[model samples]
Target: MKVLYLGDLVGRSGREAAIKRLPELRERLKADFVVVNGENAAGGFGITPAICDDLFAAGTDVIVTGNHVWDNRDILPHFQRENRLLRPANFPEGAPGRGIGVYDVPGGRRIAVAQVMGRIFMDAMDCPFRAVDKALAAYPLGRTVQFTLVDVHAEATSEKMAMGHHLDGRATMVVGTHTHAPTADHQIFSGGTAYMSDIGMCGDYDSVIGMQKAEPIRRFIHKTPGARFAPADGEATVCGVFVESDDKTGLATRIDPVRVGPRLAETMPEVV
Candidate 1:
């Protein structure tokens, strides 16, 4: 099974890049399933239902979100009807949307995808470790599902790495998001799970974490709120991770970083 997991999409540039390139990416990478982080797909805030529709139409099988999931009030009602869009499972019970979903792939196979947020340097939430354990208990890999993906949408790399180690043998891949900068630590754990601290954001990297540089810079220097932050409108580089797992064992056999577009050196996995 081949799964492609994209990082967080920030604003118009990132959203357009992902929507425009997803079809070609699916074809070129031979991805059987695709998951994307759309937490910041709006104007550098939360995503809306319209953006979700656009992504779905473009080939995204599932969309995951983080703390910014609630930035857009318009998405709250849509969650009741959309199972493919997920918020962190660690959110308090009765949260608008679920954090985990199991979907059917071709050939009668199944894949489970879940997102969990870390508490370190983040909003207070339920224990991510416990939340993940509870979610994965129902879907045993190689038995109940052929592939499982966990997105650790977090600010701290340590928390993300811990999640990967904790779910080492249980999931097919454990990739991180929310940091908006790709880490160079793509590797398969001893237990067969592919792990990467972060896959980076799908937006212009020239600014401060995809936002326009001026406001953030001024705030950093003046220590006072000024203009609101906005997404950089420059050309974006679509970033993500590609994982190919063993069909029988439901473990990752190959993992590679994928970065396409300007500003970032191009790297893609061989399509074998």
Candidate 2:
């Protein structure tokens, strides 16, 4: 099974780039499943039902979110209606949406996706490790599902790496998001699980973590609240990770970084 996981989408630029590029990306990468982090899709705060629909129509199989998942009050009810949109599984019980989803693939295969937010330097939440373990327990890789993916939407790389190691061998790929900066540590673990500290954001890299540079710069320099942080409207660089896994073992065989657009070195896996 081949899967492509894109990191957080910051704002209009990020989401628009994703919508424009996803179809061709799926075809060129031959991805069987696609998961995109849409936490910051709505004006760099939270996502909405309309943005979710646009992403879904553009070929996203599932959309995962992080701390900002609740930033938009309008999305609270939509969560119950759309299982494809996920908040962190570690969120307290009674949260609006689920943290995991299992979907059927075209060739009679199945793929399970789960998202967990880390506690380090972020909001307090349930134990992410336990949450993921409980989620994966029902769908054993290679037997019940042909592919499994876990998105560790976190602030600290250490936390994300720990989650990857924790789920090694059991999942096809374990990737991180929320950092908005791509890490160069894309590699398959000894247990055959693909891991990347962070896949990066699908937004402009010219600003401070996809936000307009001026306001963030002002806050840092003046140490006072200024204008709101807005998404950089420049051309965005679509960033993600691509993994191909073994059908029988449901483990990654190859992993590669996918970066497209301006303000970054362009890299795409060879289709063949």
Candidate 3:
């Protein structure tokens, strides 16, 4: 199974860049499943139903989120019925949306996707390690599911790395999100799972982690509340990880990064 997991989409530019580039990417990479982190798609806060629909229309099979999943308020109710959209699975049992989703990929293969937000430097939540463990246990790879992917939406790199190592050999890929900055540590663990500290954001890299520069800079320098942070509207970058998993064992066979757009040096994965 070939899967492409993209980083977070910040705002309009991110959303537009994703919508514009995803379909071609899927074809270019020959990706069988696509998962994108749309947590910060709404003006850099939360996602909405309309935006979710747009992302799906643009070729996203599953959309995962983090702490900002509920920022748009409307997404709460919408999330309850949307199977493609997922929140952190460890959110107190009765959360609006589920954290794991099972979807049929091409060739009639089924894949499960789970998202868990880390507690370190992030909002309090259930143990992400435990949450993912339970999810994977139920959807055992090479048995109940052909492929399993985990998106660790987190703030701290250590926590994300821990999750990757914790789920190694169990999931097809363990990719990180929420940091909005892509890391260079893309590798396949000895356990056979593909991992990346972060896939980065699909927004402009010229700002403070996707937010407009002036406000975040002002707050840091003046130490006073100036205004709300806004998404940078410059040329955007589409960044993420690409993994190809073995069909029989459901473990990663190859792992690489996919980056495009104006903000970053363009490079498409050598998918062949």
Candidate 4:
């Protein structure tokens, strides 16, 4: 099966680019499933219900989030109503939404998607290792679902890589989020699981990780509060990773990175 996991949708430019190109990309790539990280789909902070719906309509099967999951209080209700949206499972027990969901992919195959937050340099949360272990235990492969995708929303690449290695062979893919900078290392693990340190952001590459640079620069230079952040208004590069996995074992056979649009080189991964 062919699966596409996009990085964080930073803001307006990211959303626009994704919505504009995703349908064609899906058709051209013959993707069976698509997952998008929407933690920053809103005005570079949090995603709203409307934005989530838009992504769903645009061909996203599952929406993953990270620390910015609670930026908009209005989204609190949708968290309960929509099982397709996932927050970090490592969050406290009383968090708003679920962290795992199963969707039926093409050919009647079941795909389980889950998110876990890293503790290093991030908000205090339950240990991601234990959280993932619990999720896997609850949804064992080959029985509860045929394919499993884990999104390790985190800050440190070391932590995300650790999670990928830990879950090697158990999951179909383990991809990272939150850094908003696509890394070059994308490959299938020895265990047949697809792994990448970070899938990056689907936003304008001209700005500071998707936000307008003026505010962040001012804040950093003066050490004082300034204007709130907003998404950069520019042509965005839709960034993500593509994975081809075995239908029966739920293991990846190939993994590749994808970059398209302005501010970045055009590159597409073909399954090997």
Q: Judging by TM-score against the true structure, name the best candidate.
A: 1
Off-target runs (Cα >4 Å) in candidate 2 are none
Higher-lDDT candidate among 1 and 3? 1
Off by over 4 Å in 3: none
- lDDT: worst 10-residue window of model 1: 263-272
lDDT of candidate 1 over 1-272, digit per residue (tens): 99998899999999999999999999999999999999999999999999999999999999999999999999999999999999999999989989899999998999999999999999999999999999999999999999999999888999999999999999999999999999999999999999999999999999999999999999999999888899999999999999999888999999999999999999999987
CA lDDT scores, all candidates in order: 0.95, 0.94, 0.91, 0.89
Ranking by TM-score: 1, 2, 3, 4
lDDT by residue for model 2 over 1-272, one digit each (tens)? Answer: 88999889989999999999999999999988899999999999999999999999999999999999999999999999998999999999999989999999988999999999999999999999999999999999999999999999899999999989999999999999988999999999888899999999999999999999999999989999878899999999999999998888999999999999989999999967
Candidate 4 has a TM-score of 0.97
Candidate 1 regions with alpha-carbon error over 4 angstroms: none
Report RMSD (Å) for each prediction in the order shown: 0.6, 0.7, 0.9, 1.3
Worst 10 residues of 2 by lDDT: 1-10
What local lDDT score does residue 112 receive in model 2, on the 0 to 100 scale?
Answer: 94
lDDT of 3 at 124: 84
lDDT of 3 by residue, 77-145 (tens): 998788999999999888897889999987878999999999998778989888888877888998889
**How many pairs collide in each candidate, listed in order?**
0, 0, 0, 0
* Candidate 4, superposed: residue stretches over 4 Å from native: none
Q: Compare the candidates by lDDT and give the number of the best one.
A: 1
